[model samples]
Target: MAATVNIRRDVRDSFYRYKMPVLLTKIEGKGNGIKTVFPNMADVARALNRPASYPTKYFGCELGAQATFNDDTERYIVNGAHDQNRMRELLDGFIDRFVLCQSCKNPETELLVSRDGYITADCKACGYHGDIDMRHKLTTFISKNPPKKAGKKGKKGAAGADSIAGQPGQVDGVEDEDNDDDELTRKIREGAEKVMTEEEAARLIAEREKADDWAEEDTSPEAMARRMAALGVSADSSLLAGDGDDDDEAAGPYGEFAAWVSEQKGQDANGLSAAELYKEADARGVTKKPHRLLPVLFPALFDEKVNAELPKYLPVLAKLNTSEKTVKALGGGIEKLVEAYPDTIKAVPKILMTLYQADVMDEDAIRHFATHVSKKYVSKDLSKKVRKAADPILQWLDEADSEEEDEESESE
Candidate 1:
């Protein structure tokens, strides 16, 4: 009987609330037929708020083995001699990919399969909606066999069976017919009550009456311009523009950069084929304040696998200072990108290293950036991931400092 532990151990704070059952595994069979059995998988999956089958299938996919779960027997098996440590590590990967919300890293999320056959996690904690990586084999399995909803028919059938079993005495045809009628009437009344509560019915009537009034408001360009003025942005603000055109220019540099970013939202890194946006920014002198432009540039320029292309952007990011204000802004932009694509965390270390090598950040600036934790960027667990990614660069900086101090002492 092991105590429950936090699902993410990196989040060491006492207030960190998410927990799951300690993995319980038993190795059975022998030789090539060896399989790892998860006796408490149902409990574990229940805590994670995902179907048990998902993690089971994920184990097979990651290990390159077969997995099976018996619904009737409550058994989960993976065809391998996976140790508890290995299984735990794989389970964390599964949680990162499937269970946790990409934005807040909270387990309070629901899996939604869109009409286009894409899976997304709708987070309740942060109101963030992000698409799941369709590249994973588990995504296909989930799409093919979505979790079944519980039905009321089973309970109704059980209730009827119990009612019949209670009557030991034999009943005539007329009495049986009367019982059926009574049951039908009861069900009808229950359904009718559920269909429209008094409060709900009243609200519906009020909304219908006001629908005409709502339709009368002007939707012309002049009215829209007035509303935009009230919000303190031009009519051509990127926030108001839809995701269609890329060439449409905005009134200011910030707005223009935002408009370009919106055009590249759903596109891949290759789609950023031309350096037109960068050239335009340079022409307009927006390159001087790279920190202000970071929010738009980072997302548009890089994809999930950003490490390979990260060096190409270094010359641009180098123009920005390593001051507190600039670092804070850059951190905020990076956090927003991570929220939308959690996998981007994998490339963060390389990105930081590149920035340091290019003189965009010094040891002091990197240390200052790492010490602060903000929920605006990501949750505690994800913030830990970012810190973990930056550890290599931090270590390098520490070693360099030690070497410098040694050299200074020798000179003295």
Candidate 2:
């Protein structure tokens, strides 16, 4: 044995390695010459609702999720929903949310052990599992790529530089905190921008900066922008799916939709307000009336609306631009991610849309949303149904897997 490098704890070949595969293994089930050495299956599945899975699962961020890995083949699989080909691998500290168990959609999970660990995470909802070696992975990554230290700058402690470690690198005076933060923050922001809006990013920076009760307030726009930009986007293009700005026009077949709903008309009540009427238009998914409301306030808006069909009213954003609309509908969506679950919310669009289609108003999704909601978005009472409609419309995805047909059952 040359070095006997423990891959689970020692490798740092690529920044993207181990991330996606670990996540995928959690959901798709393990694949290798070996099988799960642990006995109980059902007992491990129910640990999600509570903090622990005395038998099947374990609790807390300190504790990692459960998963199985095969030694001989070196291939991993999940027991729940996932897309293996699109999975990513990365350096341990690089922040990213790879996949959610189709059952509960919790992305915060970590696989504590890869080979033979006690705890295993299989979402009770739809039955998904993942694999990760927490301690070994973290230690291995940190050891492989030590942080480059820059010259220790004690020039009047700036608020940011205060908490940063003031250690010197092996080379003379070179602990580049500025460069390090910039690099890390850039990666974080880029990752987030792939699935969120500019406005959303700004808001998230502001929120996360303040959410932590112990953290000092950072209200500066430049500071917030830097923070937002720190959370990098993913290298995976699947996360960047859908049309850009130009494609946002004709976002949907809205003309056909408006035509279909044209027959129904509400009375132009004497005392009824324009805002109320416009809201009605939105509810009916009819933009024509709402577009009409714009002409009164801004004559320029009318110009934007000429042939300004449902969503493509150029600058005037409409619900037809599903991406933007999703952000708009989810009040504080972009802004709250920092204070909210930073990684997950930044990449929640696809999973949310999937859940919306599945017709399942998930409790976990709701709790996550509740945690992310800002004071501006929260209300004392139910003023309207914005939250309700925004709650993903529960639906299911139809997926087919390759499996052998049971000839024994057919013999009857």
Candidate 3:
């Protein structure tokens, strides 16, 4: 394997830095597959009567969302919305950076595997199990250092670069220092400046946050300007306007993540703007941080495709039909899924059998599950057919033993 370059800091600072916390909350919370959950656009539109919040309109967070996970596909499906292409971006960033299982690295999803908090890596080839080192601090340590290959070569080309072991009076007779870019020194200074005592920084940040909140609610430009000045901002302060067009190249990895998300929109699952994603996650009450796909299927789906392509596959998967070429061949019913399910064959598709069976289909569960499908399962092509196939079954199940719940509630 090529020595991986540790862009850990780079990616960490870069990904979704421009995204707001509130918007990101909405993206994760509303989950993904909205179209399937609410086939009627009018119904979906009514639920999404939000005040132009980026997430409510773009990433699918309406008032009354009800999503569920499918046991077979191990993905989420929602009552409205579909944005598989966007979701994958979030997952790829998470898995590539965080999960480190060799089998999961090359996952095989043909067979059954355990996912009940076991540390086994999911094999991408034959579903073989790899060991999980949950107890070890490796994963946690990686958060600080991050799993990376190697650092970029400095100007000296790794040839006796700035090593701390230099002798007191000896010049290492190395590369000329004059040719180095000013950024090198600037970065060093910035790092030192930012590295204040933890307590001091905390107190300062608390005070600043309080000021920021006050500024948000305040309308006077003079007052805002004074607040900005206090925060060490210039009169034409950039951070106040969120840096507008002036890009901070030194923001590191986060520098390119916004552009990446924009370019990746519509092409990846969970495909959302940083603002929209956080908004959805907020409304749905899920993590503004990255998320997991749960149980065995996500780990399986995680393996079946490349990191780049995974974003593309999810939005088109529910329509995925029998492909014996692939071992986990979904039946003919798959393409007919949304239409065939909740009607003809089973009350729920084999895909969703596990959720209700396990009795773990709560709100949060449904939200994540819905996100998975909206991004991965619903296909525009098979959409109507799928609903026609599914709604009746769902209706039957809802009315199963009619008034049973009514009588029970009445007695209570």
Who wins the lDDT comparison? 1
- Residue by residue across 1-412, what tens digits does model 2's lDDT show? 0001111223332210111112111232345432222221221111111111221111112134333334244333323332222221221222222223434443223333333333334432244675433453333332343223323331111111111111100000111212332222233334345434635776587677658743565434444333222222111222123222221211222222221222121122132222233333444454433222221211111112222221122112212112222323233322222222333332344434422222111223333443443444223232123233333422211110111112112211
In terms of lDDT, the poorest run of 10 residues in model 2 is 163-172
User: What is the lDDT for 244 in model 1?
Assistant: 25
Off by over 4 Å in 2: 1-183, 186-330, 333-365, 368-384, 390-412
- Give per-model CA RMSD: 23.5, 23.0, 27.1
**lDDT (10s digit) by residue, model 1, range 1-412:** 2223456756753223344555667788899888889887876775565778899999999999999998678799999788776787899899889878889776657788877789988775567898999999999999987765424321211111111111110000011212322222233344345534634777688688869677886655565445434322245434344432332212345444554444454454444422334445655665555555564456545657677766544434433332355555666556655655678877776776655443344345567666666664457777767777777767776786675455334323
Candidate 2 lDDT score at position 388: 36
lDDT for 127 in candidate 1 is 76
lDDT of each: 0.57, 0.26, 0.27
Residue 197, candidate 1: C-alpha displacement in angstroms = 9.5
Pairs of colliding residues, candidate 1: none
- Which candidate achieves the best TM-score against the true structure? 1
